[model samples]
Target chain A: MEIIKIVSLGIVATVIIVLLKEIRPEFPMFISLLTGFAIFTMILGELSYVIETLSTLARRVNIEFAYFSTILKIIGMAYIVEFGAQISRDAGQESIAMKIELGGKVLIMVLAIPILLALMELILKILS
Target chain B: MGVVSFINSWLRDIVVLFILISIAELIMPKGNLKKYIRLVIGLLIIFTIINPFAKLFRFDFSLDKVVFNYAKPETFNSWELEEIYHNQERQIEKIYLKKIVEDLQSLIENETEYELVDGDISILKDEDNYGQIDYLVLYIREKTRNNSQGRISIEKIEPIEINRNLEKDFTEYNNDESIKALISDKYGIEKNRINIKIYKKGIGEINE
Candidate 1:
């Protein structure tokens, strides 16, 4: 199964990382980042399928494509941001990780602005 | 019943939206950013719930327009981006031309003793002089005061064939120059580009 392969790969990467920590401490960070990226790339196909299903469900339910698209963007942004932050954290750069997370928050806020404006306009229209 | 069907659809939409949000939450990375994401999720839920009600109330707001404006062009090629930019440029130019016409109409009616009936304006579409007024044609009629309150005097209807040139020259000399100068001062358009045609009250033909 794919899970078996993923698990084996993770175990092999962990063992290598543990061994490399003593000989070359800086090299372990690159190895860990490579492992994370490898896993992410492997699951990318499955992630697309999930997104496809979600969009189809949204279409079937007559949910606005705009909202669905916005949500999709937010999810994609979150995933990338999280991946970057984790890599930074793994490299022992806590400050860089925090900054990456802060940037992600700002980007997410930008994506949410349109939805917030839409809701605010709806509320004002209803009240008036 | 219609109400039953509406409620059914609305409930289904809510369920789907909830499922989608759940999926998003499941996939989301756990970190210090979780709370911010949760706040956005809360807003999404509220918006989805109230959206149908907004439609029912016939509110003029459209979320699609707002979202589309904010959306990034992830899938578009350079050609498609250029096409969209051109479309927007054309739309803005059309709107600008319309506003200029409206302003000119109001300016004539308020500042002069003529009522604007119809008009056409052309703008330069070249790269350098884009949006500049190329020519303006205004069909105006002299405003006449109401004779109902005062004594109505019977006047002879002038022959269209004979009096046309004289009437045209009179109007062109008196009103056209003043109007052209006014427009030139306001809009910076050349006086020769402004073509004003005056029509008398009873004349069915245009005196250019």
Candidate 2:
């Protein structure tokens, strides 16, 4: 079963990380990162299916494409930043993790600006 | 979101974050840097969790105009703001009232030396004011023995006290007369103004 495989991967990774941590402290981090990547890749299919379903549902509901795309971009930024920040932290580079998080925030804010401006303009239009 | 997708994405993030946090916990030589590092890590996790909800906050002016057309623009904003405020207020009131009920249940149980099985508190808010608690009604059930054959259940309704301090012992038992006397003595309200409902434990019948 997929569940059994994932569980085994986790257990195996944990054992390897623990053993490596005592003998070669530096190597455990790499093992941890690899395990995370492997698990993430294994579930890529399910994630894409969910995204596709949501997209079609949004289309059927007549949501504007701009808003939908901006939201998708924001979600993308969040995931990417989380992944990068976590990896950097695992490598014991706290400052680098913080920088990645800052970059993510700036990108999300940039992506949100258009929607924010559109809202402001609508408010101004209503007032006039 | 698919169950597998959620597990796949969040599981890895959780495990990685858990490992990093534990490492941070161990190797942190200084107390001050540790606090800042924790804060930064918390913020990163918060941003990740908020990713899906970012779409809900996206404002499309064209679509939102439908709501604006139904009401004056100024009133529409204020009305929406008020609705949000009221929702938050109600949630806080519910939580606070529940806490008070629990405290009161324990306090009454201790003072009366009786086991309280369950209790509920209902509060009336002032109509003219927002979030002001006006009056409280408490419904409490005693933990009675399970001697079903001989026990007669009586349902009693009683008014306790408005200004009676929770810190003081008012009524020791679930009796109507003592509670009314206590409320009248403590809050200076007339005995007629006070009402108490007394319920018999086993039968669960109303005592008129």
Strongest candidate by DockQ: 1
Question: What does the lDDT come to for candidate 1?
Answer: 0.77
Q: Clash number for model 2? A: 13
Compare the candidates by lDDT and give the number of the best one.
Answer: 1
Give each model a TM-score: 0.62, 0.39
Residue runs of model 1 more than 4 Å from their true location after superposition? B69-208
Error of 2 at B43 (Å): 21
Pairs in steric clash, model 1: none
User: Residue-wise lDDT of candidate 2 within A41-106, one digit each (tens)?
Assistant: 887886677667656654543344445544544555566677778888888899999998887776
lDDT (Cα, tens digit) per residue for candidate 1, span A1-128: 87887888899999999998999898888887888888888888998999899888888877777677767877788878888998899888999999998998888887787678777777788778
lDDT of 2 at B96: 74
- Fnat per candidate: 0.57, 0.01
**Please, what is the whole-model Cα lDDT of each candidate in the order they appear?**
0.77, 0.54
